[model samples]
Target: MAKPKKISTLNQSIWPYLSPRHWPTWFGVGIAWLLAHLPWKLQRFLGKQVGRLIHKVSARRRNICLTNLQLCYPTMTQNEREQLTKKHFESMGMGFFEMLISWFFPVEHTAPRVTFSGEALLKETFEQGKGCVIIGGHFSSIDLCGGQMTRFVKVHPIYKLQSNPVLNWIMERQRERTFEKTIERSNMREVVKTLKDNCAVWYAVDQDYGRKASVFAPFFGVNCATIAHIGKVSRITDAPVLLYDYYRTETGYHISLQATPDGFPYLDDVENAVAMNKMMEKLINSKKEQYFWTHRRFKTQINEGDKDPY
Candidate 1:
């Protein structure tokens, strides 16, 4: 009989420093590190498997995805909608692996795989000596896409703090490698200052932030509570607003930047919010599966009588 293989003792030495609660987090990081070294195609294949598993087990999130799909694509048949949801989950899974790749792998490795368009616009905006607000909607490939943007322009990304300290630390470290500065989402003064310094600020405004600083705008024909800060920031800094969006393609990742119309935030807050939503809608329609559908985009109801969709 063959001798039993000895168990690998690689991480055993660090076991003492980790609490029971932290083991899972570290285990996940370990897996992500391994995944990061794999070929992009293979990593994406494994990510699809992971996504399918999550879709099978995560009933709440699965339902939310389905609900969003239903709300957004009302005319589609049930079968078609379900297919899109599955595809979206697969893309989400790939996005997870891509996030690992973005943080751990060198930009040179991905540089060949990405094609950037409209970089001249970014350069032009920078030359103008007023800051630029790069607005984008949440997409599955966002992390990797943002990583690629760093190669073209030094941007200050505004991010929400993760609840997990270890994860947050790791993520911030990774972002610091690319971004000139990382500002907390709540730090409006810092954001304004960054803009005033003629730096690029990357902001994603698709998530639901409730009604306080938000206006009801139509996203996929559904009234969504959209954040109003994009216009406010632009007005305050007197900076130009530009839309930067990305999606995966057969060749590789495709990133594009386009300036918003002159006099954006025209008329009123509602109009500005509507314009932003329209831009998001166009990007989502380009590659529906890559859009971040799992988010509760329509969480906040427009009125008391309006029913919660998720």
Candidate 2:
């Protein structure tokens, strides 16, 4: 008998099937395409329906959101947490259809969907000649921010490839249209090459990390395995680290950008990385409602007797 494969982020068996590179991905694309062809009124209606269905079907996931919210926002009432959770899912549905159409449909259609703030921040960073390390959180409309950022400065998003070949092709094509380039995950050499060429690279750090490769950091009062790559890259390449994110607004979505303290004065120390990660946590914490709390942020726990506060 064959040995069972251990489940890891790398072996997320569902990715091959659910990924944008697969046939199932095309199903989502096809639905989005059809929705795009619909009249605006009908499209909005369909989106709302999809959003309702998403909430209905994701009961367990909703509970997870509630749990995460309760942990993060202990002072808030249950009613408030539930309301935010519902809004997150509703926005998620709208975002899903928007992403589908954005990825497959014409770019012009989705261009008007976002309103950008901190436009000058991006331009100023690019003018400095040094490469930038853009850190994004799992907030609202990340897909839109990725597309919109390309309008100003050059950005190379460090993306993990989808196992589904069909969806991967669609996503790769879409991202390439918006950014200067895309770097596949685990491709350290390519990332280095991009930085050497004086180009900015973007990364989302809201996911788990390997034990040996990460420092335990407190995100919402929980110890999560967080990557120190941004600090390491800054130390090596001296790139300016910028915190960038998008959140839903009454008008539309807004892209907020700000500079993070780079050149961590104590480069040869582990504390520098930990400090940077904590700073990131503060930024994400300030916008608790806009955060992707559904993610299993604390999936990794500190080892026994480890005095880590994260």
Candidate 3:
């Protein structure tokens, strides 16, 4: 019999994070704390400059971004694609600072900059004692915009645990505060429970999760490996699937919701996955640069021995 994977829980105590090996982590946190307090505009400026530097230095990630854009935007010229890739790095840079600002400050400070709609849409599900699943893409302003969401509606989010325990704890701690609850991406049992308890769970279906969970679907005109489990969950729980998104606006951020198009979760898994992919494509269309291009979205392929297109 195979051993079950032990889920990592949020440990609230700081004592375990105090060892000498964890000193660097603490040092980085102090620096982030200081940066979080800098004037917002200055922070954004620094983040962009740093992002430019990251684009130049992080060759592997840069290559992945370039390749993804190449695969998705066949109509775009190479030069145009390069320019957009640079801009995406810049968004990532600013997004880092925006995320810090989200983490350190109270909602009172950040709420004014964020404009959210769809509370009533979400409330419609809550009123019936049914859980909702918020389907979204990986937008660049996820952290900053996510932090502001508690002011409107609380959504339990699905996230992966980082290898670094301290970092995971710190992130989960903040998410617990911001989202009301944080469920591990692998914990489907918990996700089912959260929905049945009459709450919302935010999930992004844009990344490669291997062949078992994926059904190849059309994305930006490519047959990309798209995760199919959203349909399974919605089908089982009878939860309404709503489009969720957050993006950087000139002033601050905007978070909104939309109803998923009809026939989203057809009884056929491939049909269901295709619907999810279309929903993600719809969100990405509005905020092209702000989408998470850093992810290797095409790591999986239908071919038996195709090279992993990093």
Which numbered prediction scores highest in lDDT against the true structure? 1
Candidate 2, residue 135: how far the Cα is off, in Å: 0.5
Off by over 4 Å in 1: 1-21, 304-307
Q: How do the residues 69-181 of candidate 3 rate in per-residue lDDT, one tens digit apiece? A: 98888889999999999999999999999878777776678777778888787778678777888888887788877767667766788888777766766777778777778
Tens digit per residue, CA lDDT, model 2, 1-310? 8653422232234445464445565676677677767664565556667766877898877877787777667889999998888777766666665566567555566567676667777778767777788777776567766777776557788887665455565677777676667887677777777777878788887677567667776666666677767677766776777877677665565666776665452454346546555666786666565567677666566784554322
- Over the stretch 1-310, how does candidate 1's per-residue lDDT look in tens digits? 8653333222245445377878798888998898899987888889899899988899998899989989988998989988988998999999998899888976777899899889689878889898899899888888888888888877899887665655765777778776778887888999999988999898898899888879998988989899887878888888888899899887679888898877885648889899999889888998998988999998889885677987
Error of 3 at 191 (Å): 1.5
Winning model by TM-score: 3
The lDDT for every candidate, in the order shown, is: 0.84, 0.68, 0.83
> RMSD of each candidate?
7.7, 5.3, 2.9
Misplaced by over 4 Å in model 2 are 1-28, 38-45, 262-287, 304-310
TM-score-sorted candidate list, best first: 3, 1, 2
Better of 1 and 3 by TM-score: 3
Ranking by lDDT: 1, 3, 2
